[model samples]
Target: MAYLGVDIGTSSSKGVLVDASGTVIATAVRAHTVSRPRPGHVEMDPEVWWREFRDITRELLSGHLGGPDAKGGAGPASGASGGSSPTGVGVGRPGPVAAVGISGMGPCVALADGASRPLRPAVLYGVDTRAVAQIARLDAELGRPAVLDRCGSVLSTQAVGPKVAWVAEHEPEVFAAARRLFMPSSFLVHRLTGAYVLDHHAASQSVPFYDTGAEDWYRPWVDAVWPHMELPELRWPGDRAGTVTAKAAAATGLAPGTPVLTGTVDAWAEAVSVGATRPGDLMLMYGTTMFLIATVTRQLRVPELWSTVGAYSGTRSLAGGMATSGAVTEWLRGLFGAADRAVLLAEAEQSGVGARGLAMLPYFAGERTPIADPDARGVIAGLTLEHTRGDLYRAALEATAHGVRHNVEAMRRAGAAIERVVAVGGGTRGGLWTRIVSDVTGLPQDIPTVTVGAAYGAARLAAAHLEGEAATAAWNPVRDRCVPDPAAGAAYDGLHRLYRELYPATRDTVHALARLRREAAGTEDAASGGAPS
Candidate 1:
């Protein structure tokens, strides 16, 4: 039987069907964007996630549910399977689904009522910096050392607790009725099986609410943050959450009583997709926002980086994420009105090394990890009037590379041994961005065969659930490696020094501007923005 995997991402929802042998039978994606209500406030309607999920699932499983052996060249519509195999039959034919895996962009705060109805729009992850004040207040209230010891990381914009506090303090009406908490993955799982559970990796990002050392929720801290809220049960990313219910089956076409595996954040799932589970293994996800997940031997705690339970039980991770990677590039693409992304990439390549002596800081959505500054704004330095769009685009690419190097240095300082880097996600599709990152960091990245990302990883996990540990062992293999050019590396080392200095040099001005914007806020139009989620 084939496994079904679905991931609700920031910009879209993607679904995949994979056979027991790890061959991708079919893949599907539904494109959408997040909402920017006000400055630093990024949100999305929870219903949109479920709606897109339903659409993607039906599309993946579409075809006549007939006998596989009785088929007379049964291939119809738009789906994945055709040939008959021992594990699964092709799409239009009767291919029994073995299990389901779910993942999403997290650790988001999707507050719901007792009945699991979302009270308001789900507040996004680190990129949404509306809870800066709450972060400071919580750090003071809980004590920084106590928090770091319990949570394995200090309070920051990425912490779910602070965002929940923001809602309690600001939107009291919604907070008053909220009794259940859900991130994207947990929300989807709950909808599927009525299982009130979340994976340990996502739970750890809730900061004060989760005790990393104990590997469970710290009830006292949870009560302190938002009184009387019922938290979901915690499990490993691959653990079986529950069987799909009849209602959920009817809504999504997934078989009733089918097992649904617990899933963590999207980045972690993508990391799993490339088999980056061993210590010293780092997974670089090149998506809307670049994510770096370094699997470490032990939990490396530092204020600059996030230390959370890895996707699996025995493993641990020290991770860092850029606030905006492709997001900045996409914004620039929109401004330039470049009809095709390939054209922009080609232009950026022609612009070359230093982007015609221009430099950029890709903090359009504010910085996360290492610098963790929400007020940080995007900057373009040394831009002359004659600088072309190609030059600006090249600078943006280099800027992300610089940011990545900064995070890598922080991970090293935290004692993470990053030996092998596996690159995954949509950004890896273009060689130019990966080349720039390799040159900037001086680290070789292993690119896998199936880069469809989280959904594929989810499918792998589901395969493991059915066939035991051996099922996921030989899945996605590395096909190519992006190595650094020593000549380009030497030049980037010098430019990176300048990139680091640029942020601190302009922080004060950006903070002042950010404050002014907040003071003068309130807009009727909700702008649909950001790269991919």
Candidate 2:
């Protein structure tokens, strides 16, 4: 029987079907829009996500994934009986998707009623920082070290508990209405089955609600922070949550009664997709934002970066986030008025190593990871008329690399022993983008054969949890590896030094300016007794 993996990403949701032997049989995608009604606020209708999943699942089951090059219905590399290559394989395999696994962007808190209907739009993970005030309040009340010792790090806007606290403080109505607080996967699983479960990786960041050391919920801590809300049951990522309900089956085109495995965060699933299970293997996810996750033997707590429970059981991970990476690249692409990615890539390649002396600080979406500053803004310097679109494009790429360097250095400082990186996102599709990152960081990267991101990884996790089997053998293999050029590496080292200086030189100044602006807004709000914060 084949396993189905679903990834509920920030910008889209994708599903993939893989056999027990790790061969991808079918793949389908459904895109959704992120609504930004106000500055710094992002949301999505939970129903929209369900619809996308339904469409994608139906598309895949209807033979859309069985291209001409695919194995004659049996899927690639899966040995059929007698090695005869079974015909009409995919045609009859839709109903028997052995297990379903899911993963998505997280560290988010979704407020839901007892029946699992989302009370309000999900308070997104790092993408939405509306919990800043709540983060400050929790840190003050819980003590920084107190939380770090228990949950692996101090609570931030990214933490679910803080977002929960935000609801309690700002929207008490929503808080009172919500019977359960969950993550993306938790909400999805509730829809699939009647279960209210959260996987370990997602649960660990639930701050104060979970005790990482004990690997269970901390009742006292939960009472201390959020006495009003109910936390969900926690389980391993691949553990079966429940069988898909009849209603869910009709909505998603999935078979009724199919087992649904506990889900994980999207970045963790991406890590599994590219064989990044080994200790010290880093996963660089380049999607809406760049998230760096490294699997470590034990958890490491560092102030700047976040240390969380690993995606899979029996391991730990050091994760970091950069507010901008691919976003900046895409933004610059629009600025250049480029018609296609090929032309942009070609232009970026034409420029020299340092983008002809142009440098950029990629804080377009406000920094995360090392700095954790949401107020930070993007900056481009050293631009001149002498520069071309090629130079500007290359600079944008280099800026992203610079951000990665910053994150890597932070992880090193935190005692994360990362030596190899497995690149597993859409960014790896661009040869120049991959090389630039490799050169800038001086780290070789491995790209998997399919690079299906979180969805494929979730499928692998589901495959690993079969009745009885070896986890590693059931997954696909890595295909390509990119190494840094010695010459380019040397050039990037010099640029990286300059990149490091940019933050320190500008941070204090930026903070001061931001404070003044906030004060002015606050003063206006005080006068009106109505203006929103």
Candidate 3:
């Protein structure tokens, strides 16, 4: 039997089929778009996500349906013990997916009916900054100390609580109609099994409403934020959320009553995929955003980083994220009007490390974790007329690395003993980018050969659970590792100090400019009879 893992990402949905021995048999990916109707707002239609998921599943499962072991070598597509392939639920049939697991990009919250269909477009995590007002309200109501103690970090627009408050105040129609609220993974699980449940890893994003130390929901914060909304029952990753219902089976071409495991946030699953599961294992996700999840034995509350319950039970993790990573690269590429991504990458590599002394702050999408500021803006310092596009691109890459250093230092302050870094995501494929991050951070980075991020990890999780082995033991896979060059490290050590000063030195300046820009935009919107939602 094989296990299926699905990842609901911000820009796409990817799936992987893994065998008991950890070999991936099939992989599928489907892309979708994020809409930005107004500045600082990002949204996606939920129905679009559901449709893409259906298409990809059918595409992956169709070939194996009629197998005579369907090896694609001798005969037509027929099952090993098949008579034109049995369509109904049975062992070895395409219908009975042994076990299924899920992962998603999160800190997002969506309202769903009792049936689990989203009542409105999901308020995306990190990308959407409409909850700034709500965050201020939450900060005032909960008091700084209470929020910091409970959440291990100050409240920010990125947290789910503020998003919930946004829905309550702005879109009261959808908020009033909501039966329950859930993050991305929980929403996916609900659609699969008709159950409203959440995994603890994703639940951490809902803080101020969850107690990381107690590993349970904190009632007081919930009452203060929204007295009427009900939070879902939470479980650790790999626990059972529910069985596949008839409707879900029909929708996704799976068997009825299939086991569905409660899953985790995409970053946690990415950690699993990279073999960063044990204490001191650090998983660094390089994607639209930069996320660092380090496994540790104890929960810590640091000034900048967040300490949260780990994906698995009886452990803890220190989490930090930068609002933009690869996204900044994409933005710069567009500004440069590069013909293709390959062109940009090729130029970036040839430009060499440190971007030829160009420095970029990579705060284009605001900042999260370590310092929860939504008004933060990107800055390009040390640019000169002689700088080529390649130098600028390389600078953009190093800026992200510098951001990684900041997060790692914050995690260290939280008492996380991060010795090794396992890097995953499409960005890692850029050789120079990976090496620069290693050089900047002074840490060895392990790069797996088959790095598909969260979806691949979710499949591994499913394989372990279905095969009845210790899920943790069964999911470890190692490939190549990158060690830091001492000479480059010394250079970056000085550069990092300069990188650290750039944020504080220019934060207020950027804020002042951002205020002016927003005021001018608001005036235009008022003249135009208000902005779109």
Candidate 4:
């Protein structure tokens, strides 16, 4: 018995601790970052996600091998004799944790009040393109084909209803002391089970306030987009969302009531940590933005992908994302200072393939799914002084492999039968950005064996909801494969047709330099008396 998992990502926060035969045992991370306050604003401060989930659950219950005793008591229970170790890892004795999962990087909003707190900093997700005029005034007063026929997705900047109507039309006193709404795994499951709930795959990416064929919450598009908030209870990212609250067990040493689970979003827990949840599978991931998901069986609506529901519960997905992959090679290894990432992945693998003539467009942070352009910028078409920083980090890894071959050709033009891809996060570790996204999506990936993503798929959805077991393909498998080369297919099919014609050949000069950088960040937030956030 062990479990526990965590996520929250978009720069970092992880956690793990598997066991009960599915291995892993301990892991932790925290990192942090994300608060581009203005230019297409991105944020973070749900109290830095419960202070990095209580500093990664007190460094994975205080590691050094022996487990869970420092303060997280309760040991030994479910099928008693722990297991694993012939290199699968978990060497026994971390007994009884039995649940607590979570995930994040989401269709985020995180309003809160009525004591849940946070009312300002949290409008992230879909790379926060500051709600493009509340996604065109909620697609012109909720219509765009009745919101892609009842929220299979359409209002874009990836929905949460135009960032809660850009905070009820620009922070009406934090939307009049907002009532509640959270993401980042239901704001850490409403701070460890004070439970305000939310999980049906992050409420089906909170589009026209969720309805994906009536799976729930559409109340006339939440009474025309958040009529004074209050709406969480959804639950299904492996159910059981309650337990663990003696003030979150003294700020996270587990025990007080244990059980937690309702988690989703971290690319559907990295597509349930790579079992890629069936029906034609897909799950790309490759983090700090470049997700894919797929797993369909129905509901394949495609205003260029994102059809939600399916973190288990009959299943259905289609998703796509790419507001930047490996964040444009960590912004060309922080503009070539290169102190890490194996020295810019060994100088972008000797700057080969097309990076020589370059053609990037990872859209820095202003594009998602098929071309849900959020003032889409980041172009970089061919450059000079004879290119280097290894051809601009191999043209930002072949412009995130031509934005994953234009989102796998918009998930095969919405029909979505994407056989089987896999690939998981931390940019699928080296191997030249998964062999340039398999020679620019000629397809063929796989690579699993515990990518430790979405905190090991939220500890395999808390070991399949407290040990009923399907521990994600027996705790992760398919160790390697990347295939597709065929002589680099005519140079990634002519650089994916100029990365699909470099976004309408530079969308009106990056939307007029994103409206003069949002009017110089709203005149430096009105000379610092702050406002445009």
Q: Which candidate is the best by lDDT?
A: 1
Q: For residues 142-193, write the lDDT of model 2, one tens digit per residue.
A: 8889888888877765677767776776678878788887676767788889
Best by TM-score: 1
Query: What TM-score does candidate 1 reach?
Result: 0.93
TM-score of 3: 0.90
Listed per model in order, the count of residue pairs whose N, CA or C atoms clash below 3 Å is: 6, 1, 10, 0
lDDT of 4 by residue, 1-533 (tens): 67878888878777788876667877766666877867777888888878677766655665523435444432221111112111112344577677888888888888888888887888788888777766776678878878888778887777888788777876788888898888888888878878888888788888888897878888777878777777878869888888898888776667788888888888888888878888998888887788888888899786777888888888888888888888777877887675588877787788888878888888877787787877778889879887878778888888888888888887887788888899888888877989888888888998987798887888788877765654445778888999988888677897788788778877887777767777766733311211112
lDDT of each: 0.85, 0.75, 0.75, 0.77
Query: Given candidate 1, what's the lDDT at residue 484?
Result: 99
Better of 3 and 4 by lDDT: 4
- Candidate 1 lDDT tens digits, 1-533: 78888898887788888888888887777777889888889998888888766666776665433322112222232222222111222454337788999899998999999999999999999989888778777878999888998899998889999899988888889999999999888998998999999999999998889999989999999999888899888899999999999998877777799999998899999988989989999999998999999999999889899999999888899999999998888899999985488998999999989898999999998889788888788999998899998998899999999999999999998899989999999999879999999999999999999998999999888888889867688898889999999999999999999998998888888777766666677521111111111
Model 3 local distance difference test score: 0.75
- Name model 3 segments beyond 4 Å from true: 65-96, 469-476, 523-533
Sorted by TM-score (best first), the order is: 1, 3, 2, 4
Which tens-of-lDDT digit does each residue in 1-533 have in candidate 3?
A: 66788888876778776666666667667666677765667777666556555555554565444422223221222221212222221223333368888888787777776566689888788667767777666778888778778776566655788777777877788877776777667777888887778888777768678887677888888888777767788887788888889887777776789888888889998987867878989998988888999899887877477777787788788888888888888877878874487777788888776677877888886787666676678999988888888888888889999999888888887778997789999888857788889999988998887788898788777766666546546454667888888998998888888888898899878777766666766622211211111
Select the stronger candidate by lDDT from 1 and 4: 1
Model 1 clash pairs are: 1-87, 10-533, 11-533, 81-90, 81-91, 82-90
Say which prediction, candidate 1 or candidate 4, comes out ahead on TM-score. 1
